[model samples]
Target: MVSSSSVKIVSKCFVKPKTIPEESKQPYYLSPWDYAMISVQYIQKGLLFQKPLGSIDNLLEKLRESLAITLVHFYPLAGRLSSPEPQKPNSYSVFVDCNNSPGACFIHATTDLCVADIVGAKYVPLVVHSFFDHHKAVNHDGHTTSLLSVQVTELVDGIFIGLSMNHVMGDGTSFWKFFTAWSEIFQAQDSNKTNDLCLKNPPVLNRYIPQGYGPLFSLPFSHQDEFIRPFESPILKERMFCFSSETIKLLKAKTNQICGTTSISSFQSLTAVIWRCVTRARRLPYEQETSCRLAADNRARMYPPLHPEYFGNSISALRTAAKAGELLENDLGWAALKLHQAVAEHTSEKVIQMIDQWLKSPFIYHIDRLFEPLSVMMGSSPRFDKYGCEFGMGKALTLRSGYAHKFDGKVSGYPGREGKGSVDLEVCLVPEYMEALESDQEFMSLVSL
Candidate 1:
């Protein structure tokens, strides 16, 4: 077992883009979507790979070089958050200060622990958190902290590449797009190809401002620390529950049969099962209400639809509620239908309406406000190409998240290692609740591993 003292930092440096663009000299405007996530913690995700044949120094050099090249296309990441109206004491507008911007923080660390110590653990080892550079930093910290940080941890027999991106910069889709592009650039160079690599669809850097909304929106907080602090999480246990393709298919079928409708999606059905099971394990009162919130990708739901490559936070939290008694009393299809309806109702018009509402009174979303004893908040998606990222060695062996945004009932979904309709749910809950969940036959029967 890897302990708190297992990992050691070897070296650290800042990596700037090889060629900074003239456009990068100006401030990068942030949209309302970006502003909403200012208080949230940075997204910490990492990929594990088998140790390739090369010295650690050589590998680090290539990663840094390729990363520098990658940043030219993602210049905003190389910038820092700053208030355009620093004179205003009551309020301030935040934007990416690309001019004289410091580069992304690059960290190199090592651990004697091997792959088995992590992937094979009953509960994910706490040492997994050390692989990331920014431990508990929120997005607003980007003002002084690096907007993006990359930590490369050399394990005994494997390598872990961890990335921390300011949540305000983008959502899961945007994050993966950058990762995939960086990998492509890295692979091209590793294969002795030309460095002038053209991405299939370069990111559209144009910031989105609703037609009536102004480019600059002032936030209520005068100081960054006042808006966000390092989240002090509760004592919790994390476990990855895997559901195979066959299990999900059966779940979908069961849901459709119970709902007397075939419209419930596999994702929705799976979510329903988790929500119901968690509620059951919590043993909440029959009269008490419980909610499940899913992070809905608004890119497709927006009017005329945003570009597939439209980077930045394009997500909305869709919350569905039902009495715990009713939820537990109801069948899987019943629960899934409630969730399905909430999602189906969020049409393109509704998305625009949400933006308009937020524009009227822009408020930062703090996860603390939404958390409840029995509530569940699901982020990330199984649709993301989690295993596709290959940083020269091979495809990622597994995907993991750091300590950021973790709380009881927080569930993050990832495409299972086996792929093809499989799903892995990283479920976090209070120790007692987790104990109940692990012992629940109904839930354990569905978990493949």
Candidate 2:
């Protein structure tokens, strides 16, 4: 946790759009994927920007203005959350009340910390949490809770924009769409062609029609307790492992040589390496069933291939399960092939079946249960381009999921700063396991300090 004294919260308030969105005065029901997280709170993320060229106050005012404008277009973000059966405590059929929200939470904060103090170093303290709303992480603030909470923190060297959006409303893809929209609005004020600017594809709020998925039954299991052991501990640690383009090339080549196939991608290769390292470091039993849950984006794979602007949760993960000895003793390509096949098998028909199965089984049966011991899950996508979200100030040097997304046996993947074939992984785990991974010679040799 970040010390309260480190970042001073100067002011906090809600900012609505310059004009209300007339089209969304009614309640809208979220899809099954979105509603599944109603009890989990928002998806928290942060961005790092180099110091802007103008006065801090002016820059903030511009941001506030742009945020209001952005909300007009992304009206769903301005909605409040509610369940269809308010009296039923376990009801997971939650909906977004678009007519009731005042606006999103916006905070103006200042800190003495600098970007250099946190960005590159392996052991920077909890600066990311200091920027967002910690109170709302596990509990709902009130009935009028803002779907989105954005905090702007200023330091001597740079600024951090932290976002906490209700996961029931959107996933990373939708969040980035709104973020990029806000950036574009902020930059259009100074751009040469302000009127000509337009988002590539406007957000489509209609729930994606499941072609083959049916006979849903998730509402009853929604009452089950959330599987939260992986997220809790006496001490939670976060670290970043950097893999350069050259290292990734080497890894891909190694995987190809080991698997006797030339089709492995950078993601497949790197995840395989980390999966093996984690399993070896944990020193689990030879027969222990270890699983690597790889996040698979379902946007381009939908039956109709929905547009990138299609909002809400469109993500599905693939599980690659194997014995500890298989991963620890076998060639890297063995794990790589498992991962590659798992991800490759998530076709349109497969996603529909997955949704169907999920609706019939326990809520969180597939994803959250996989968080049990001896399992690793990967998060976020490098394709979303977190670094490309450039406001009027500049492009983001780095962006992270922070503590909001951290858990033991979890890894977050991000594109390298240069956007080459490189990848950046943020790893979180128990202290002993981290110590074990730190000492693993093979893992150390492949990573850039």
Task: Pick the TM-score winner.
Answer: 1
TM-score of every candidate: 0.97, 0.90
Whole-model lDDT, model 1:
0.88
> After TM-score superposition, what is the CA distance of residue 383 in candidate 1 from its true location, in Å?
0.4
- Candidate 1 ranges with C-alpha deviation above 4 Å: 86-89
Pick out the ten consecutive residues of candidate 2 with the lowest summed lDDT: 224-233
lDDT of 2 at 370: 40
RMSD of each: 1.4, 3.2
Residue pairs whose backbone atoms clash in candidate 2 = none
Query: Which candidate's lDDT is highest?
Result: 1
Residues 104-167 of candidate 1: C-alpha lDDT, one tens digit per residue: 9999999999998888888888899899977888898899999999999999999999999999
The per-model lDDT (C-alpha) reads 0.88, 0.74
